[model samples]
Target: MARLAMAMQQEKKHQHVEAPDGGWGWVVVVSLFISSALVFGLLRSLGVFFVEFVRYFGESAQAVSWITSIGVAVQQLLSPLGTAACSAYGSRRVVMIGGFLSALGFILASQATTLTHLYLTMGLISGSGWALVFTPTIASVMQYFNKRRSLAMGLGFTGVGLSSFAFSPLFQFLVQLYGWRGALLILGGLSLNIIVSGALIRPLGPTKVIERTKAKSLSDKYRSFFSHTCEYFELSLLLHRGFLTYSLAVTFINAGYFIPYVHLVAHSRLVGFNEFQAAFVISSTGVTDIVGRVVSGWASDLRHMRSLHLLTIWSALVGLFLLLLPLCSTQGNYVGLQLVSMAYGFCAGALTPLVFSVVPEIVGKERMVGALGLLQLIESFGGLLGAPLSGWLRDLSGSYILSFVVAGGFLIMGSIIITTLPHFCSCTNPPPLSPKDTKNEFTEEERLKQVLSLDSTENIHNTDRIPETLLSQNHITLEEIPLSAKRTDDDADC
Candidate 1:
């Protein structure tokens, strides 16, 4: 029994060291597809239900807006907690719990009699479940693939676009047939798919926990706990300069990124469009969004293109499309509206894949979970207020024009801010990968050859250029390992 246990442990360690870029990764991607399909896809299509709530509950647009706003805000705000749970217990366990809570939230919401009831069930309960599922699924998908990270993320997130396309119309049909209450009940049952998604997420093997010791003092135990906490939650990222800069830009971007999803359908109604026409607007965006995400995923993977650069371009384009929205609503005809919606959807979707990919390039993959959680926690403020503020503007001014323009302005500001990052200092230069980028695509034999071969030894320093005075973690110098010493080591391996 002892030998069997030891062998199992060794096998797990070996699998953990070897990147399984495909095999189970495709299963993980399918799980991500379903999770994304239900989570944000439903959220984006919630605009179809927005007007129903206003009329049923006798609330103003701004007051009713909190229904989705609170849900989105809660999801983002609690992401760190959810991520911490996933890190402590595998992703599958955390997400399964989330799936149950999510279904319960919808079940409770189906019986809601007041706006407050909706807030508790639909907002807090459902949002908490989303927080658990989202970060874990996304972070897990990234861990499975190194070479095709961008493409995997693109495919996983495209679920949002595909689901959004079908959901908007289907939600409208369901609401028409069964009313919002019955719709909620049916939606609750549909949300059970999250459990299957969660179950599909196999454990990534046990995380390396530090061994406890009887010899350690209480103070030592406390210090060790703090260290593990920092590693698990990546709290140290708060102090990282690169993280701070990128986060600041995303903060600005989030302030407006969700405005269209929440308000565009309502905006169409206000501008004299019928129910079908309004829903079609969202559907159109969903259609183009699919194309944008897939194409940009491939684009970001280009040998010469940087993810951050692609992000900048996409952000700028999204802003441009938002700025054109008011024109589409007022002076522009149906053709103009379609064109602008297509452009906006494509650009917005294009930006999604690059956002997460750029993080691994800036920080190492090991810190990805924490970095994503912290970013979500910080950006929750924007998600909390973005739609409500848009609703408030409409309440005050009786139009969405100024609101959309301001949203576009926020994105434009974000696009400009990201350019000031260390990599963007020069338009022609790609920002060098961080010193800790341990992503090596080389097979075991190739790695052995590189480590042992005496030819082109300088290439061991992977980054563009580094001075001898500043030796990075991955860098090896002649003074440290003379050729004579390397030859002796190589001969032993042979």
Candidate 2:
């Protein structure tokens, strides 16, 4: 069992799929860009439909809010399943199926007659598709880059900002031309493009062989499947202290992170801004969001500081801006609100890529897919409650002021939590892997060659004089060698 474990670890250590840092990675980045836009970019713009749903269905704000909240929550909660599927099937097939599901949801949603229908179609179905599309795409991008990972993530996610800028007004225009139902049909068509993007995702690592056996009982097959899933999903990561703390911090951030995207338009209208003006506010923020992502990505790649430091600063600023957003409505000051919203947009965008980028640093790239999936799954609680909580506050108080304040508080709490991460105060980059960490880095073939060369040497009499470093490199302790393999002086004389 120990040998088997060591062999598996050695395979991971020696044959790591080296990040190209560029090359076909650039293509993966492009696919990430497209999928991100269709998924989150479209999601961010869905606020344009918030008022329409409220008025059309005559539902309370809190009730209508559940539509988006359910979708967000469902997408996040199912993320682990998506990553698991990516691990079993290739990412390409899983993502393509997800794309189809996403489009099917929208197309089916067009004929909905009730909010429940919307919840089932848009919230459940499309959200499931999003679950499959996001984690794998992000994981693929991470695998294809090393030093420039932050920048690649930033560039890929720029699609969200750009589409947010474009999709808001475009959605409004579509809603104006065709009722909400007709607009959904068009959106469904747009979602089909996610299928094409899925096709562009090339696997970064060699495919693992699917274990198989002769006929077995049904229970045996089920047990085997569960065992395979547990190994592939890296379920033990749940016990990792650093990962848990990081996930907790991110969950708090998630609680506040999406409040604006879901409510900013409604808040604008409440402050006496017209629909176009409200839409423009979100669109303008999207523009700054793009700038922030690019700038943050470029600066992170410069290696002047830790990505955690940048994330901490941006998270704090994002909370600060969220707090200030409510103040902009004191006298219905559109300009002030818009400017504050843009600032919030920039901070939000800057921190997003860092959120994913820092995971590799925290857990190492080998566990990225599982880490991302688990992170999303844990944070889904925040996403599940955030918007609806904000909406309930709005309903209770008849204003969004308290809601924004509470949202900001969640972000601030997240920022404080981030300060406790291991090595946050370090002044220098982390040291390279120690010998203990790299015990399996040497290849089996190299160890065999070294053994043969040592045996061929005429002057060497025994393994006692073998270099400790060489033994350590080969992950073999002196005590583990058999007595029969070690030559005795008496035997040598004979």
Candidate 3:
């Protein structure tokens, strides 16, 4: 008990303090809104360049698919590094550097003479920027709000929809006015605004700067370095059941999540829609997507249902719509395609905020950054394979029907996996603070009892009761025990 309390006191010195839940958080949200517009919003709109890339490069769809896939892969695969950077330097510095890298990648890609050049410049370089930008920005937002977290996330992500609504057609126009190369150059210029967004992130709590201390030996120095790295990245989360299950479920969801963004425009053209018509289809969905995000955020904050429940419902709807996309195309119904795409857009947008909001539920707010880093690291595989597989299916079948079907399958599988989350089957949404407070109390009591039991073999299984005499002898009090014991039995005592 004394050790736990001592550890808790030491932890407070370096903790990533929770957000005040308001005030400058709104400014951070505005920053998030802009960052989302640049990152994901631009990503989804890049599909406007897909067919152009195929025609210009004369590469197979599968080969061309590697462009976006590699970018998404690198972004996710390197997220742990980004989080570590944020822990060492503040998120502001790391994100600004990311913005510069992102713009540089786009500018360099403007000069690409071959597909491999695109892969290196756009895929790796631009992806590295995204890796730096994404996890830190989301973690910043989570640090800012609590009860209103869903709404805050929803409002922030609406930038994706807002940008998509404008960017799809705007990108197509840029392509026509100047070639794809020129268009990419202009994108590089626009991405510089992300640096401004990064500038706006005033970290809500303690500055994340780590204090350096001299070590007695080289081995001690290495051990201290490893310890700091583990602490900053929360490597312990790897052993957490709830976090692991959530990561796996999100991985499957991610496998299907981006198919529409990457392929929908191309599929529209394949179904005989003209260029503007196809662009409009994406733009229209973007409008609905905005509505969905705002509504989802508002609804989630109502606290009438668990965020996990809302996420499952949204995931299922998104999968159902993905399945419908192919059906509408097979029937040669452009109107049906547009409507189904809009429906898919709404459900997908609605789920975005919930995706981040649910993290605090799985892991407490203090661990949000590391948990997000690990989650992105694990889910990167899905992001890596999703689009390329869809493109490959398109090449083999000469249509996108099977691609949509397979993507939907992945989403449905994700929905099923999420049902395995702890407390997912519970009927009522427990008041947030009550359960946490009660659980903390229960855990410390039980842990102290176990220690007492361990001290005396006669009381081995008598964990339900703590002898008062032993407590007096040990100079322990229940109130003095640290609530850090509020972790699952599967967790390490530390």
Q: Candidate 3 has which clashing residue pairs, if any?
A: none
Which parts of model 1 have CA positions greater than 4 angstroms off? 1-16, 208-225, 426-494
lDDT by residue for model 1 (1-494), tens: 34323433343333333346788988998898899888988889989889999989889889888888898888889988888887667789888888888888999999999999999999999999999998888888887777788888899989999987898888899999999999999889989889999999875555323111211221122233344455456665665667778887887788788888888988888888888888988899999998999999888777467788889989988988999998877853666877898899999999988888787666555467777888888888878888899899989999888789888988889889888787675545444443233233112213433343423333424332222111211223235432201111000000
- Over the stretch 179-242, how does candidate 3's per-residue lDDT look in tens digits? 9999999999999999999999886434434322211121122223434455566665665678
Clashing pairs in 1: none
Off by over 4 Å in 3: 1-18, 211-223, 428-494
- Angstrom error of the Cα, residue 448, model 1: value is 38
Per-model TM-score on C-alpha atoms: 0.82, 0.84, 0.85
- Ranking, TM-score, top scorer first: 3, 2, 1
Clashes of each: 0, 0, 0
